[model samples]
Target: MERSTPISRRPKAVALTFDDGPDQIWTPRILDVLADYRIHATFMCVGKAVQRNPQMLRRIKDEGHIIGNHTWDHPNLTQLPLSDVQTQVLRTTEEIDRVAGVKTRLFRPPYGDLNDDIVRKVTSLDHEILLWDIDSWDWKGLTGPQVAKNILGHVRDGSIVLQHCAGPTETVKGTLEALPYIIEVLSESGFTFSTIPQLLHLSAYR
Candidate 1:
């Protein structure tokens, strides 16, 4: 299946987003890397994680990074009932608003799982569905160099690069290690990193 590129007016811009996180150890590390590069990215945080790490979410927002809902438990929305899908998305939305004091304007279904009904349900809740064009695949136990290669090899203008900060130790390790290299290489190539809302020209918070 062909994936659609995210909408962007600037040809040299790319939106970097992380999923399933706000993890105690990895999230902060990723934040540190972003801080070092002085770049901003989006984080699609799971509700349970947000509840567990409200301070991390606060830091993400405080640092000018956008946060999106990745659902409460990271379920495949396409297979779930519509009501269950609503619960998953809305619960996360509420949790984010509760912690960050801002309603999320973006949603990325777990595993990129979505269908017409799921889309409708999410939109009904006023979220723009977000997906990525470039996947780092850092969760596949790839080394940091390999993950960096995967991202840089596929990245293009207006790409949304998907990565994760939560998972097994190796997954987090590869992602963290590859981040600085990704930022440096892409910046040298004249690409500016952006948050999803910034790239899409949508509201980051409601």
Candidate 2:
């Protein structure tokens, strides 16, 4: 009789991805909080930030977080030329590779916006496109309670959440303050945090 492979069992995991970062102020604080909770996240970084603070990029990689492409300048990708779109993704990926020694195959378009032209260029470069199922509106003027509520309200099995490392106004503080409670409630409800790659592995598209 042939022996069947024992399936590796894993929990229902959710992905938490941050965009427009490696910010000198907030990214480090967010990293510390994630480390304290022993959770991992995916950071979609801008190429210019990577170029300016290679060390922060290195720290992000070293801390076991997944890195992804978020373009050189945060813009509406649907409005940009194909060549410009290609340059944005490729340059960011290359910069991350140069500093972190890891070439990313994942990308999240800025503003969750993409057009056919952008799509063609992204696929041509062989990067997987990431879109969120849940947006916490941390980029807007939502309070910490609102942020936490938005996340907890929409979170579900295999849900991908959109948060940020750049807080929009002086009062927002990057929404890092909401993370602990979010993680706590989610974990209590039997949710496990995973990076985008891990989430993809469990997704039907994979």
Candidate 3:
């Protein structure tokens, strides 16, 4: 379906979303960080990764984070045949449902790449495209300070900030390092961290 508009928007809040995860290594540690701050962020999980670590996905849900699908293999949706694109999404959705016991309508295209046809196909599966407003670029091996600057420099009320905990060690190291500082700074500014559902007032799972 079409992506959601605000049912009611929360003020002075930001949504922290992690993509391509349910990672066995960094995810648990990242979750620990979120727990320490009593924050609930969103995790956009890939199917094969989840298969390797279903328990991690379960942990994500058990701890109250909303889980969204990031496709089976993180393919660019606009480049695939529409049927293949649908399969990529459905397969991941099914895996998430099996592991987490929830069906999420939230779907984020890999690399934020999508076209009208891709959207039509994904919407056919009842998924609402969930893209981010802020990209930390942590995947490119930006330093912790750089990652913090990327987010803090652009953050605003109701912004969706993207970071990843699942990737090469070097790629995620900066993100893990920057997370606490970013969270603390944002919190001190009276900005609350929200999961996507909370920010947008949409159902997290169905």
Name the candidate that leads on lDDT: 3
RMSD of each: 1.3, 7.5, 2.9
Candidate 3: misplaced stretches above 4 Å? 1-9
- Candidate 2 pairs with clashing backbones: none
Query: Against the hidden reference, what TM-scores do the models get?
Result: 0.96, 0.89, 0.95
* Ordered list by TM-score, greatest first: 1, 3, 2
Model 3, position 4, has a per-residue lDDT of 26
Please give, for residues 86-190, the per-residue lDDT of candidate 1 as tens digits.
898888999999999989888888878777878888999998988888888887889999999999998877889899978889888998889998899999999
* Residue 17, model 2: Cα distance from true site in angstroms: 0.7
Candidate 1 colliding pairs: none
Give model 3's clash tally.
1
- lDDT of candidate model 1 versus the reference: 0.88
Candidate 3 residue-wise lDDT at 36: 99
